[model samples]
Each structure stands twice: as structure tokens, then as C-alpha cells.
Target: MANLLVTGAAGFIGTNFVRYWLEHYPEDRLVGLDALTYAGCRRNMDALRHYQQFQFIHGDIGHYENICQILREQQIDTLVHFAAESHVDRSIHGPDTFIQTNILGTHSLLKAAKTVWLDEQPGLIHRFHHVSTDEVYGSLGPEDPPFSETTPYAPNSPYSASKAASDHLVRAYHHTYGLSTTVSNCSNNYGPYQFPEKLIPLMLVNILNNKPLPVYGDGLNVRDWLYVEDHVRGIEKILSAGIVGEVYNIGGNNEWKNIDIVHLLCQEMDRAFAERSELAARYPLAPPANGQPSTSLITYVRDRLGHDRRYAINANKMAYWLNFNPDIAFASGLRKTIAWYLDNESWWRELLARAAP
Candidate 1:
């Protein structure tokens, strides 16, 4: 059984990964560490408390000594590094935090892993998997081929730039210091437990509250959307069989324009309300309850600064080598995400209240 340390365990994708790990690897000892930032909700891990083999630590990944201590104490042989400042808009407004957390924080973790797993206990079986985004590949044109593992780095925003630096650091560590590391650059991820700041969740919440659905630019920006669960599975495949020094691209192969996604979501919302009478009472402010289409709330807004026009990931490497592929269809995944938010109203409501100024 692999003793594992998962950073950002309280955040969206991290939370799902933690749950998946615990459920599938019951015999493995797992420890989750999180700084509990605005996006890293402590409540997200409340359900995992019942597991005897899991432990949660409230801490930041920026602290080097603390990470060293955790690595040594937990005897952690597998470290899945997921902690980072990931919001593009927030990073654009305030880049200092992104630089600190994404670049410096990742450096600190690498240092700790090297000190504990390499210098102190050489030949100790281990793997350090770093999670990253495809934004580092910059924008793609309508006719451009999707980004592959070999795609050159051309980051646009502060968030993507910071992540690109960290990705380089991980690669450097593997090549220079012989650290057992692998990197996966994934496309957009959407699923349950995702913070409302993201596109899908933001649109869903606004549709429920009868607020305007803000679409950036012409809402024509295209992205490959991978469900969080499929992304997690891709990571597991990398850990199980991927080469230590190689990079993998994980994608859903489902590219949807921004406005088209919003429109589809609106249609799904309308269907939900029409099929279930209880939804109308639960979200009375929603346009669906008042016999109006959720599309009525669509309101175009200025596009984000340094916004990349499109991002598509070519996961041929992951499929050909690791035998991995995303199983969830876009419609099925979207429906599940919407149902999750509606059933767990208290969760998102509390997060919204906390985020309110």
C-alpha cells in the first residue's frame, strides 16, 4: 500500500481525488493537507472524516519546513501536488499571490521531497505527480491542432505563466536532480464541489438566483472541458504506469464554445424545472419558476484581460501509452453537476455567503 500526501485536498479537484483514492485504496494510508483558502473549503472534506485511514492537516504548501516534516512523519512515498492559485481573473488582478503560491510554493514542495525522499533515504520507492493546466500552451486558432505533450509553452495570463514556471521546475527536478516526477497538463475541468467562481458553477448559481449570466467577450472562446472524475482517473493511470520523466495531456475531447455552454446549461435548467415541481419552490427567484427561459439572464460582459481565445488538449499520449480515456459524456456530466448543486444547496449557499463582501 502506498502512503500518500495530497496537497489542496480541500479544493474542488483535490476533494474529488481524495474521495476517489480513499474509496478505491482502502488499505493505503493517506494524509490530506490544505491551507483552507477561500476556494479550499474545509466543509468539502467533512464526509471523509469517517475513514480510519485518512488524516487531514490544515496547513499551507508555501512553508518548506512544514512540508519536510510532513513528508518525514507520514513516510509518504507518493506525493500528489495540487495546491496552487488557479483563478485566471483573480490572478490578473493580484499576481503576487499567484507567483508566491504557484512558483515558490511548488519549489518548496520539491525541495522537501528531495530532502526527505532523495538525500535522506535514497532509492526509497516514490513518485511526485504535479497537476497543471493547458493554458500554458497559449491560445489556439480555429484550425490549429490541439496541444500535445510536446506543445511549446506560451502562457498568456499570470496564472498560466506561474503554472508554466512550476511545470518547468518539475521537469528540471526530474532531469537534473533525478527526482521521480511526472506532469499532466489538463484542459478545463467542471464537476461537483467546484467553486462558484468557475464558469459552469457560476452560471448555475446565477441561473438559480435569477441573476445575470455574465459571458466574457463574444462568449465564443473555446475550451476542452474534462469532467473532474475523468481527470482524476487519468492521474491515477499516470501514477500506476506512466514514465517518471514524461509529460501527459489529459482532455475530455469535448470542445464547447463559452456561449454555447451557457445556452446548453440554460436549456438543462429549464428541463429540470419542468420535470421537477420541487425545484420551482426551492429556487423561486430563478427564471424557470416564473415561466421564463434561463437564457433570459444571458448578459455579455467585457472579456478578461490576456484571455486566450481557445485551448484544446490532444490526449493521444495518455490513450496510446496509458490506455486511458474519459468515459463521461458532456451532457451526462453537466446534468450530474447541476443535480449536485440543487441537492446540496446548503454547501454552495454557505460558500456564496462567505464570498460576499
Candidate 2:
């Protein structure tokens, strides 16, 4: 009956993690804290409203007093910190929020945890898990091996830099204060309930609307894609069995260039629409253009600032040590994700409408 406090539980990955734990560990108490920012939506966790073991707290990790109070009130024995301003594009447009949320917020959480956990009994079975991104390693050459836990920190964008700073603070806490902590740096994640601003969901939505699908920098940037469920499983494994003060890298081993992913998604979407059209005459609204289908929606856009050329992860450590292996392949995962978006149009449409200025 361990009490787990998960921050950023309304965001894509965090929400998935909360749902996963609730379903898998029915006896354990789970507390979710989120500020309900633009990216974090309560709708993501709507399905869990009936779960008795789950609780939700509206707060920001950047506020030290608030966090300390939550920790104490919730009797949190395990902390999974996922709160951060994660979008690279948003970070580029405004870095102050990224620094404030990713660095200062992490600092505040760590301080509160130290004050609460360190002062308690010495052998308490408490763990602090930090979720991070491989972007902290910067871009890798085409031929370079994937990023491992041992990879040096070389963050490029403001988002990655802030994540790097947070990672450092977590490590410093472990080394300096003997706080039991583990960190997992994961590659790009894509799946259901993801905000539309991200690459996959954004493109999916645009393609559905017959709008131009923006591809950055000729769409050559490569990233290892991990399904959100696989990522959640890896995090759970690390939280349950990982050694304290260790770092693990989670990846799908399914590396694809940006252009390739878009093409694949377009193909899946076309097939899906074709199937839907067969069921209803007015489905898709617009027929495939000529013989080209929705792939024609791809439109090259300006590259992002300091865009990393490529990012891959060497997940051998998680595989051999933690027995973690992603079950979903890229193609199958993309199909499922696309189907989910198609099925849950109302969910994303509401988000899109709210995002519209």
C-alpha cells in the first residue's frame, strides 16, 4: 500500500503512468498533482475518475511550500517527478517558463523531498524517480551509437538545457544528500492523449483537416520513437526494481527520420480513412487527392532553432538490468495511435479549440 505521488499527472506521459499504476496496482494509493497548465488537461485523466485508489491535487511543483504540504498530507513514499515545460518549440519561443518550471520547479521539489524524507527514519523504503529526455545529449551523428546512461550531457535547445539542469539537480541531491533517487532519460514518445502541438498528433490532426502538415528542415531530423505505454512500463519497472542513484535510458530501438515517420503516418491515415469511407459515404469529407492520398499534405517548414540532427537511445541497460523491452513496434503503435485519435476526435478537438487564439 505504498503512497505514490506523481507530478505532471495530467500531461501525456504522466497521465498514462497514473492510469497504468492505477490499473496494475489496485491496492496502492496514487496521488496526482498538476497545475492544469495549457498542456496539462484534466480530460486526459477523466477515465480514472471512478478509481478509488487515485486522488488528484491541483498545484505547482515550483511552489516549495505547496509541494511540502502535499508530500506531508499525502504521506508520499515514492515520488515520480514529471512536471516540466517539455515542448522544444514552446521553449524556443519563451525560455523563461522552461527555466522556471524545469529548473526552479525541480529544485523546489527536491528541497521539499529532502526536508521530509531525510529527516525521517534512515531505512525508509522511499524512492524519487525523475523522468527526463535524451535531448539532453544533444544531436548525434548519423553513424554514432545511440545515447546510453553514460553519455555526456550536451543539451542544445532551451528545453533540453532546462531538463539537463533538472537532471543535474537530481544527481546532486543523490550525491550530496544521500537521497534515494533514480532517473530515466527516454527518447521521443508518441501515443494516445498526446497534445496536438507535438509532431505525431499535430501532423495527424492537420492531415485529418486537409491542412498542410508542417515538416521541419526537410524533415531529416531522426529520433528513436517509443510508444507511451512502453515508456510507462519502463518507468514502472525502474521505479520498482531500479537501484537508487542510478540512471536508465528507455527507447523503442525503432529509430526513424522525421520525413519517414510522416510518410508512414500519412499512409496509415489514408488506409484508415479509406476504411472509414467504406463504412460511410461522407467519411473523411475530402477524397484522396488524385492518386496521392493524404501524403500530399506534407509541407516543409523552417527548421527549429538549434534542432538536433538525430537522437537514438541505447536501451541495453534497461533491457538486461531491468528486464524492460517495449512490446509495441513502430508501425503497430502508430496504427493504434492514429485509430485512437480518429476515435477520440472530441477529446483533441476540444483541446485544439482551446488552443486557438
Candidate 3:
């Protein structure tokens, strides 16, 4: 059984990955390291308490000594690093945290891993899987092709810049120090347990509360959407059988404009209210045929600073080498995500409260 350390295991993708790992690798022992920052929540892992093979460590990855201790104590032969300051808007407002966490935190983990795996056990097999985003490739024009592994780094926001730096660090460590590492740059992810600050969840919450749904600019900015579960599976593949020092791109190939996503969510919510009695009472609204459609709640806001025009990914490498396939279509994933938020309002309420200044 592999001893796996999953950093940032309480955040959005991290939480999903932990659950996915438990399901897929029952024999493997796992340790979760999280800082419980504004984005990280213990509630996400509350359900995993009964698992015999899982342990949780509430701490910051930016602390080098702590990371070394965790690596040594856990006997972590395999690590999947997901901890990062990921929100573009938040990174823009306060870039210091992004630099501290995404860049410094990643460096700490890498240094600790290098010391443990290289210095302590030279012959032992180990892997450090770094999860990243597609925003590092910058924007794509209307006619531009999807980004591939060969795409040059051109990060547009502080969040992506920090991640890009961390990615470079991972590559440098692999090339210079020979640390076994692989990176996967993924597209936008949407699913259950995701913070409402994100697109789909935020829209769902706003629509449920009958509040104005904020849309950035014309909402025409495009992003390829990957279901969180599918993205987790892709990460597992990278850990299981990916080539060393290589980069893999993971995406849904389901590109949609921001406005289109909002429109789709409105339609789905409308259909839900019509089908479910409780939801109807909570948000009694007519169908899209009515002039007072739920889409009326859409409120255009100023565009985000350094917002990318489009982001698409070419994940053929994962498909060809790892046989990775993202199965969730946009509509189906949106429906399931909406259902989850509607069913679990208390979880998001607590997170929103923590985020409120």
C-alpha cells in the first residue's frame, strides 16, 4: 500500500480528490495537510472521519519545517500537491497571499520532498503530482486553438502567475535535482462542495435566493469546464502511470461562454422548481416562456482585472497515454451541481460567512 500525502486536501478540488482516492485506492493510507484558510474548510472532510486509513493535519504548507515533519512522519512516498491560492479575483486584491501560498508553499513542499526522498531513501520510488490550471497559458482568441503542453507560459492574473512560477519550480526540481515530478494543467472545474465564490455555485446560490446574479462584463469570456470528479480521476492517472518530468493537460473539451453558462443554469433551476415541490415553494417562478424569466436576475458587472478572453485545453496526451476521458457533459454536470448546492445550503452558508469581511 502506498503512503500518500495530499496537501490542501480540504479545499475544493482537494476535497474531491481525497474522496476519489479513498474510493479508488482502499488499501492505500492517506494523510491530508491543509491550512484551513478562507477557502479551506474542515466541514468538507467531516464525513471522512470514519475512514481507518486517512488522517488529517491542519497546518500551513508554507512552513518548511512543518512540511518536512509531515513528509517524514507520514513516510510519504507519494504526494499530490493541490494547495494553492487559486481564485483570480482574490489574488488580484491581495497578491501577497498568493505569492506566499502558491509559490512559497509549493517550494516548501518540494524542498521537504527532495530531502526525504532523495537524501533519506535514494532507491525508493516516489512521485510528486502538481495540480495546476490552464490560465497560465493566458488568453485565446476566437480563432486560437486549444492550449497544449507545448504552450508557453503567459499567466494573466496574480493567481495564475504564482501557479506558473510554482510549475516552473516543479519542472526545475525535476530537471536539476532529478525529483520524480509530473504536472497537470487543467481547465475550469465545477462540481459539488465547491465554494459559492466560483461561477456555477455562485450563480446557483444567487438564483435560489432570488438575488441579482452578477455576470462579469458581457459574460462572453469562454472557459473549458471539467467536472471536478473527472479532473480528480485525471490526477489519479498521473499519479498511477504518468511519465516523469512530463506535463499533462486535463480538460473537458466542453467550452462555453460565461453568459451561456449563466443562461443554462437559469434554465436548469427553472426546470428544477417546476419538478420539485419544495423548490417551487422556495423559489416560485414561472418557466422561461414567461417574460419574467429567472434570467432577468442576471446583472452585468465590470469585468475582472486581467480576465482572459478564452481558455481551452488539448488533453490528447492524457487520452493517448493514460486513456483518460472526461465523461460529464456540461448540462448534466451543471444539473448535478445545482442539485448539490440546493440540498446543502448550510455548508455554503458557513463558508460565505467565513469569507465575508
* lDDT agreement of model 1 with the native: 0.95
Better of 1 and 3 by TM-score: 1
Per-residue CA lDDT of candidate 3, range 1-357, in tens?
Answer: 999999999999999999989888899999998999888989877789888999999998878888888888888899999999888999999999999999999999999888889988897799999999999999999999999999999998999999999999999999999999999999999998888888988888877666788999989999999999999999888888899999999999999999999998988887877677676554543333233568989999999988899999999999999999998888898899988887887898899899899
- Candidate 1 shows a clash count of 0
Q: Over the full model, what C-alpha lDDT does candidate 2 score relative to the true structure? A: 0.90
Q: Determine the C-alpha RMSD for candidate 2 after optimal superposition of all C-alphas.
A: 1.6
TM-score of each: 0.99, 0.96, 0.97
Output the number of the TM-score-best candidate.
Answer: 1
Candidate 1: segments with Cα more than 4 A from true spot: none
Q: Candidate 1: which pairs clash? A: none
Please give the ranking of all candidate structures by lDDT, highest first, separated by commas: 1, 3, 2
TM-score of decoy 1: 0.99
Candidate 2 structure quality by residue, lDDT tens digits, 93-127:
99999999999999999999998888754567789
Q: Model 3: residues >4 Å from true position, as ranges?
A: 282-292
The number of clashing residue pairs in each candidate reads 0, 0, 0
Model 1 lDDT at residue 33: 95
Off by over 4 Å in 2: 120-122, 278-292
Output the worst ten-in-a-row residue range by lDDT, candidate 3: 282-291
